[model samples]
Target: MSQSKPSFSDKKQITYYSRLTQLGIGEEILITLPELSGLMFTSTRHCRTLLGQMHEYGLIKWEPKVGRNQRSTLTLLYTLAELKAELAQNMITAGDYEKALSLIDNDKALFEKLLVHTSGTQMREGQLHIQLTYDRPFSSLLPHQPQRNSERFLLRQIYSCLTRCNRDGAVSDALAHHWIYDETNLVWKFFLRPGLSFHDGSEINAEVIVSLFKELQTRPPYIKELAHIQSISASGALCIQFELRRPDPGLAGLFADVRYSIQPISQLLSTTKAIGCGVFQIQEHSDEKLKLITNNQYHGYRAFTDSVTIWQVSRSKDYNPGEIEIRTGGLVSNQSSSCSSYLSAGKTNSGLSEQVHNRIEDGCLLGILNHRSHFTDSQLKKIRYLLFSNESLKNKLDQSLDYNIEGVLAYNLLPNWVKLSAITDNDTQLPKKISVALFNHKGLEGCAKAISSILADNGIECDINCYSFDEFYRRAFASTLSEDLLLTSVNFDDNRPTSVYCWLLSDPVLHQSLPQQQRRWLYQELEALSSITTPQNYLTQLEPIATTLVASHLLLPMFHHKQTLHFEGLLQGVKMSPWGWPELRDVWFEQ
Candidate 1:
């Protein structure tokens, strides 16, 4: 086997030749010079040189300017049988040779009329094409920097977390081959896989792991997560140990988050561009598109597609067939026929042959009252009653938004898994007028308008105000909200119920504007709840506190927003995280 192996320098050339041979004899392949150049990762001049060499060898004939937009044609001179024999002699393993032959045999018809093009290149037998939406144009490859859903999706391809969380909420190893927790010592030790190399060809080991965590600690969210960590030390090349201030059962889940992806310390300091050990490597990235090629040296399950291209689309209607379109803004009432709609939670439209929708229970939307508003206590009580009890407004919002009101309705802060008794409502008379403020997120505009309309129908005169997210945050921090009520949403990325409540109650900007006695009691209640370790005890202790908070009308739980992913065609082995992002490693195109 070793004696028949091709030389390292010739391997890529052989692979390229093999791909061309799969086209079979007499096949007129229509491919633009730019497309071929991108596929080969070379300049147009270099691609021309490679094509000329192939033409000289009698493997293919290049016909210049034969198709639309001056695209050239390349005719293959070798048959599949001849290519199989050539690959058999060059491939290091019998399995590789057989796989190559099988692909050619399976896609024989496609090869006969293959139209090589950009955008849909991944739809071809060995490619994967995807479309994602970003809020704005950016080039930061760092996993933590990109705040949009599209950028985060692209980052997942380039980065690998220490651990992975499955759809069933199970924690599994990714970079860390195995891990163990020392309860008595409050220590967590992880054993990494051997011989793992980053995309930049740097070895992954314990020292690198420790350094990444140390660097991560300097960031905002990671700093909060790692606050309990006393120290992170490397025992050897393959083992890393973390000492914590206290026992945390959910520590492994924290590592499973993509934000904590491990990267080389050198890359962290040297550049903002990413260098990862995941299944894909960034070939090129720009404001409009992000292109990735498979990382052959990846230690885990390799992606089936040779390359993936993510296009930044302005609207859902821009999606095309054979592409995975991620629509962060909920599906509009008017969906175009260009592509089938798939919810982010993995639900498909009825009768749509090619669609994938994965529903993720990500977070809840809440109605927050500005406690510092000038309204008297009685007036506040009436406002809360009108907002929560008005079913007409909720229904209109639900119909316009196309969301299940009952399914997403949140009566408590805890997730559905933790069942707490519902709060008893004390009805109050409607006030003459009320004002509500909403952040100017495009998706929330319809819902906010619906609320205003509903309030108008009642005796109350409704004043609806919109503010930019930054302006809203600034006013919120300064406790100078102009509206009586604020409409906003919060994602509980951390599955732990305690963490969710801690964030809600402990936010200084949010709760500081409350009356002194109410603020004191809220903090006191949170402090007591924080001490309970067991989930059962915690839930039992939290029931009355949640009830009290709801009754106080400071925060009104509205509904949980279900995250969905819509795709144009069938995708196999697709799964989603609790936070609504797709697990793309195992996903493959199904034709």
Candidate 2:
């Protein structure tokens, strides 16, 4: 009989090959059915099924041990790199680029080629489909539940808020075409466009708006933000009225918030998908990719790009984003043998260029020190010194930031925020060692390892804890912070006072976990600060509070950083949103 070939598509075959490849290729001296089964993630019976297949491929030599506790000798015929490359090639040929990239073992040439094939904007079946890679699988795109900036960006495309804040920080009409506030009577009325509908094609009228807010009456920030409203009701088919106990000038900004994005109540309760009324609708979402198509029925200008496909891929994605040159004035056709077609209305992209553009972002790799239970004041000071005093460590931290956040060293983003003050007494009896907390995200484990190594070198004991976004949000709200330091990146992406206010209000560990008296005082201070209108006035009033935060060493802002993103010249009418993502709504992909 002819020897059978192993199928890469078969999970069992792939697992068997992968495990055999790890058993010291032709050098393995001992093994057993149970031990082998555990390594392959299959039962002993399943392991037996793979024995014949493994032998048939001449990839593994297996000798069975009949008795329990008896050792079996198994030896592989191939190295891991050899097996992975073959499997990765197989996946690549099959057009499973996400899976292919995951299996690649630092094959730079292969990585680039796979990325080139998987990425870039292409015209397909009357739609301009732009493809890009993300580091992980799709998570919640629900209006209020986004855990990261990427998710937030996707949410903006998939959902519509009552109002929207523009690049100039001015509030503009969105779902609500026109709104008026009766400041004297403490009442507000919003008029929705007639014939508006949700993504599901259901009528999205004043009644739907009123019903959604009623459901949100119990959720966070909303409960506090909308508390002044005595009643919210529908005036007619197209009008919503809010009767308030107090005047709320910030209602426009509040409605612009992601928390208030309108979605069907039924889909809001589903875990598998998010539905809304925006310029784009989720056509397909899976572990490999999230596909969004233009909603032509959108009340606003229809999205120029018909589709955007975000491929869930590994960071091994390496390709020159400058591949497509964006030139204006005259049209340029492809000189190569390959035929060129329009990806969008007038955009014509030529191949890769040697030139690249740089974008300096205003963000930071912030280290928020939990000033409560974990560490004493003295210990916190020492920790700060060990973290910030060394220029070498800052370089390493900057590198870590680049890997994790795609950021560069921020020398002076915030003059008052990034404190470099040294500890007065290095020899004074140091306080107890503390734990460091990290978010469970890509490239963050490396940050934890780097931090732990630096502290360990200085004779300091450091424990590391990782939490998912859910755990981080849920625990912090209950005023339970177990770690000494909560290190995360902050973009202040929204770039509005509301953004700052939202940060202060939502970060329970930063505010709510404070001493009862201190928390109350801060709340009152924020309440007063919220009413200030002018920038100078806001800063003048906020300075004292900021000073207290830094001087008291509540949370140490260690490193402020900037991220560099590449945009092709062909991408036209694209501007970075306040949230640090490129606004794709009206982009032409002009080449």
Candidate 3:
């Protein structure tokens, strides 16, 4: 009788062969199925399936012990070429094969070819190695420019904000040791931590603080943040006082924005010479990569690793699983790739480890109706009811790819955190025809199709218009959006509802369209919320305002999406900020 050949999934074959090539001849390795599962981001059952196929193929002898501690062992029985042939047949990438071979031969050249750069500490101490991919090349390290999350991640490491928001969204001291608010005088007194110094060894004082604010007042984003500042003065040696135009309780939150990273006045003119009192100092920066070294002169906790190197790859597939990887949404796939470990944020489950899966509640998706468009108020209200009231439509839309329904479907502008009275359902007449504008991005086309189908079922004609992201932004800012409805997203920098309120009011286009009375009401509500000192009470004050806004039918809240991070087993003490960036100061490699 002829012997039959065993079959395996592409993931199983690649993982098995890769592991085999890493071992020396006659070297035995013991790996518990659970441990292997964690490493591969696979289920224990799937790991067993892979082992079964390996044994059937005569690739390894799987010995199972009857004890909990002694789980199973895999022994190599095939030559390197034989394993290579299997991997090639399974269609593993050339880069992956080279990575595996490099591990076997202990060759640094092949590994270097795959990575952008490897630091001396990483090479010598087997320290943490991280790989990141971005959609666009990094523009600037300057704080004034609008930055993506990747840029902010690097900035947080190399720069220091006056106040920092912890994982729980509470404000903590960074450059400033502590601060006080004088309600009577409408002023804030910030006391700098003594002995604070920049990377160049100059002591930080009230003059530096005042100078930074003066520079900030000249830039955008900060222009709005500093508009209420009546005057800023350096008091004593370490004290800097700011007199506000009004009594604002959320002033600390404003200082905590990542864009407010304090820099020396002397280095402000030189963009290349970016310097701050952060935990890490910039060793080198370019469009392709950023290299950082630990700051021994840091006043607070020091980074556990000596250096960090971030490379901007063009695509996620370029990421090597052998090193730590950071990626945004939509890059990971359903099938596991042996080339690298995976972490997914939001609603994606592609190769995500349960331990590393995180859900951030700060991101809110909105469906804003352009009051300037053709739709009338009644028509808009009816459309909102049709979309939000139908449970079936919500379920179908929730199942769409990359759509995370973890957050409550927003009926109003306020996030689910704020309690508000329920919106009473009323029967209304639907418009015969409706036009919706959606940005042409990944997964949104499917969403547009779903919405069209839903409206069609209700006997209404739906027109879905898709435009590129640039064109969409152009139309939005120009107030020339022809569609009655627009889909958009916004993220709050701080946990306070005041930030959300400010964002709603700051949009020049949106603000211009609001009626005079409504605009006055918005400013009045903002003042009320800003005066509340306690966060809980501030949230309480948001309910009435949110209820009034939702009744206006101007904005519809859809859902909130969370960001995720995946780390290799070698990384320890990893804590991510609320803004979805890893706090690297304490992250260390596990032995």
Which candidate gets the maximum lDDT versus the true structure? 2
- Residues 187-283 of candidate 3 have per-residue lDDT tens digits of 9988888888888888889998898888878754455557889899999989999999977876776677666778877665666668878888888
State in Å the error of residue 453, model 2: 2.8
Q: Provide the TM-score for each candidate, comma-separated.
A: 0.60, 0.71, 0.65
lDDT of 2 by residue, 1-591 (tens): 111265434555766677666566678668778887888888889888787676666657777778996888887776766666656654543446667767775665666545433354555455666665555676867875635656776788898988886423467888899989787897889999888898878989988888888777766645666666889899998999999875566667667766678887665567767778999999988886788989988999998888776665543422111112122112332311111111222222445332223344334455667756546567656665666445645566446533333344332224333333555456655544668776775344555666777877777688988888678767777767667777665544452445555565455556644556666777777666654342223334554665566555555554443323344555567655544445667666533
Ranking of all candidate structures by their lDDT, best first? 2, 3, 1
Q: Any residue pairs clashing in model 3, and if so which?
A: 321-339, 321-340, 345-564
Query: In candidate 2, which residue pairs get closer than 3 Å at backbone N, Cα or C atoms, i.e. clash?
Result: 323-352, 326-569, 326-570
> Whose TM-score is greatest here?
2
Report the Cα lDDT for residue 548, model 2.
66
> Which of the two candidates, 1 or 2, achieves a greater TM-score against the reference?
2
